[model samples]
Target: MTKKKSARQLRGQLMLQIAAGRFFRPGFPLNETEHRYTVYSNAWFIGDPPIALPVGEVVASTEMGHISSAMIAIVDRLEQQRPDGTDDFVIATGGTDLVDDLAYLMSFALNRTVSRNHDQTRRLVTGDGAPRGRSANDLFPELFEPRQTVQPGQWDDLRGFMKDLLSLSRDDFARVMRVIRNSVDATRRAPDDPTGAYTDLVAALESVSDDKLSTSVTWDRYDGSKRTIIDAALIDAGQEVADRVRAAVLEAERSGLKRRFISSTLARLSPDYYRDDAAGSIRPPRAPDLERMLGIAYDIRSRRSHVLEDLGEGVWLFTDGAETAYEPSFERVLTLAGLWRLIRHVVRRYVINAEKVAPEPWDYREALPGIVEMQLAPQYWIWQVGGLTAETATRRLNGFAEALIGWIAGQHSDGLPLDQVCQEIEGLVPTLPDGEARTSLIATHVLWHAWVDPTDHRPEASTFIDEYKAVLDAPSTSAFTVSLLSNHPMPTWSADDWVAMAQSRNDTRHTKSQAPLPAVVDALIQLFTADELELAGRHDEAVAFAANAVTELPGNEALVGWEARLVAGDHDPDFDVRTFLFGERKREVSEEPSGHEQSGEPSTEQNEAVTVEP
Candidate 1:
């Protein structure tokens, strides 16, 4: 058979179970059978340990009281440290007796020296017997009057025999008044009733005297009377007392005294009572409520106001109850506000930088193709130039071109060399025009340049070319020139080449027929040939002259096509030759019959068709 556990072991197990249940089974009902049984068992174990208490038991009780006193003393010390300096000493010291009693009870229940100061205080005041070592008389001296036997006759010895309990601190005084107030409230008397429960409170207050010990009682009586009497004098007196305390606080603040201490003391005396201005004398302005006060301070700091100059120092100086030797200056305030604005500006710039508002150079180039398609259209250009003159429109076109060039040159995979681009564009600005039209023109020109020049490695080059073609197809004089300029194979062309081509075209005296078509073609070819083909090297006359040869052989489709292909290499330059021919020769050919018919005869379609020798 297994051996039964010893009593001590069983008790230890029970204690452990109780602790575990309390900790882990949080939602378990205390009223449940298991919980009740556990609590009862724990209590029994506490009261009756394995060993009984010694016969004397003096050591246990004495030790309990000592521990209790130590706790009370510590609490009393903390209470005394309050800066308000109001007398809470009675409440603080009275706690000692309570603590001692609690300790004794705990020692009795646990059969061990376990001190419970909190419980001791409750027992001393409310317990049945006249408290053990000390009576209520000794602990609360302000609560009772001196006992005296009245002699026979002699006005019944009324003066000295009267009890006075008014010397109590505000807390104790309020506690007594609250008791009366509660009694009145419980009665639920109507305000119109003069001889009601509230009047009874007044009668109770009147029983007290006018000495230091009776001041609180007198004030309480006065206040209680006002409720029923409706006398203006009583109302004014109550208001006067409130005003005095507020005045004290304000004076302390103005004089740079310990305002916090004064204010705290006042608060402790009567938390709701504060001064208000009376008629006749100029009462100081009532201080703002805490939130309003703080908000005003913030506004002053925000605006950096110097309005506190007359009072000395700054507005914040008054809050700390200290005066600055030097007064605030208007200039200083303005400077501070300016500094704040500057700080905000810097912070915004930094945040914007972190967010990367400007993209990398590679990103711009990558997006260029899409941007050109969306923004550079004939209608869009016209819309941009709306009311501008041709001269203005041309200037804008040039500026836009320069801007694109700058953007291309500055672009890199890492980041756009924005600073360099800006500098270059700034240099080009003087050579360009002003206004929105100028901007649009310059942009169109730069886009055209990117489309025609294969050396321009901008990722958007193809998109630019496509958009340029779309714009050229739209019927407009400007669109024709833009398309021609963009599709022209003249990436290497210099300013002189353009001037020479114009001069050569003027010299040809080409009407809208015969030499007209060839002259136009020749000028384009010559311009392409004159471009700076090789970096820092002499011009290649062979390539240049070869390009010109294509334009010279008019009506020879094969030769012209070959020469054009050679000049542009594998890249197909986007140009509309039909549109150019139509624009220049449309009027000249409108009256003539189409080549589909023979001249002076209605010839058959087969005879009208002539094959040109290749």
Candidate 2:
């Protein structure tokens, strides 16, 4: 039909086509700068119909031989982009040519449909579509219902978590992901090689789990002469190398392999499980039971290795049982499901806490503004006021708060009036330290109500304002401290006063000698000024100020909302300013252990394999 068309033309030749997968949910688009391909989940590509040749979620433009590996790498990366264990970002890959083949390979690896390029014009001449021949396991679909779809708001969180995971060293990141993939594969392999699967799963843990063995050698028992002799011998033998021998000896002498494994696993577990009760969550197994279970698991792995033990045909059922319950079997072994769950936990904990990923994204001040500020605020004050690190600030704060709470509880139990307790707390304010006194006063007020009477929580607004005025007048007083001190009561500061205070704080913040004031302090200053203006009946000025404040502090939703309301002239008498940094509690506070006391270990009596929600 075209002067005898060439064989290459009749049968479409393989081209270096750029393969891409469209994620069902939003993600922060990554550039091809560092990565081999780009992720186009950002605004430019989002919601656009996939009509173009190179739609975003780009894996790579490679020769046919290397395409599968590129797809696998991309899928692996995308898997980590998930926000949490619950939700999955559906990355559906598709294209006309070898893109379909690449997507099929990805689907086979992930065991899910990643492609929808049904009308493929190209074909693999030999019909070996996947790079590696597809396995029987890939043909069967596992029972999977996505718990929830990731929301658009969570895409930034996904980006943050992914960035952290991806930032790991090549070996470390690979090892972590390898362990994770093996753990998942181990579960799937239960039907045919249950014992082998169990062995692999246990081995997976051993590979990643820290032995937590102490390498420090205690020379306290040795005499001075012997110590000197040993040191000389070490120096002669090469000091650093000799120290490794001593450390190894000490580590082996102190703890066995099993103890090390148990210790590491327990250390990784959520501390919440160690509480007296599970606090309405699933109760984790007691330490001894978990130890026993892990011991059995190790023994089983050993049995499989030494004697070639088989876990029988019903192993899959055992692997599918509820993770929070013990196996009702002859040996009372922990269910494979429970063990698998623990493996996942251990793997996740290892990857997330990897040391090289410096200053974890989740721990960043901006990510969890209020809680992180609370964590770092003590350090800030310690440096600002006392020229100390966080030696005893936390303990001191907790001790002070505990004493005040107990005193208030005791006073209330002794039938003292609530107002009298407030007065008593106000008296104690004078004896407290300058930087911490106001915080202590506010704590005293809040905790008194929480511990004593939730119904009548607030003191008379005037009494509260009067009692706090002296503290507020201090030059060290910050907007954060002020906000915590008052909820609904308008600060006595006028608009001009607020502006001057902000300027003073800003100046201090920029001063080299001074500890930097947190941005929240300035943001709150603008917010409080807006409130003052609104109170002054200058609606237009209030709107303008709030709009400017939002620009200054862009991420705070409360500021944006307040600005919008002001613009719309919608005034509600009950409206109170709420930001992620500080918000008035809308629910009754529950009695819980103080942070100082939360380190209590779990009791050994309650022994059952349970999921730790935390």
Model 2 steric clash pairs: none
Model 1 RMSD vs true structure = 36.6
Which of the numbered candidates is closest to the native, going by highest TM-score? 2
The whole-model C-alpha lDDT of candidate 1 against the native structure comes to: 0.28
Which tens-of-lDDT digit does each residue in 423-475 have in candidate 2?
A: 54555555556554445444434433434433544556346645665564433
What is the Cα-based lDDT of residue 397 in candidate 2? 35
Residue 13, candidate 1: how far off, in angstroms? 54
Query: Which of the numbered candidates is closest to the native, going by highest lDDT?
Result: 2
lDDT of 1 at 162: 11
Once fitted onto the true fold, the runs of candidate 2 whose alpha carbons sit more than 4 angstroms away are 1-160, 213-255, 272-288, 312-320, 324-330, 357-614
Candidate 2 positional error at 163, Å: 2.5
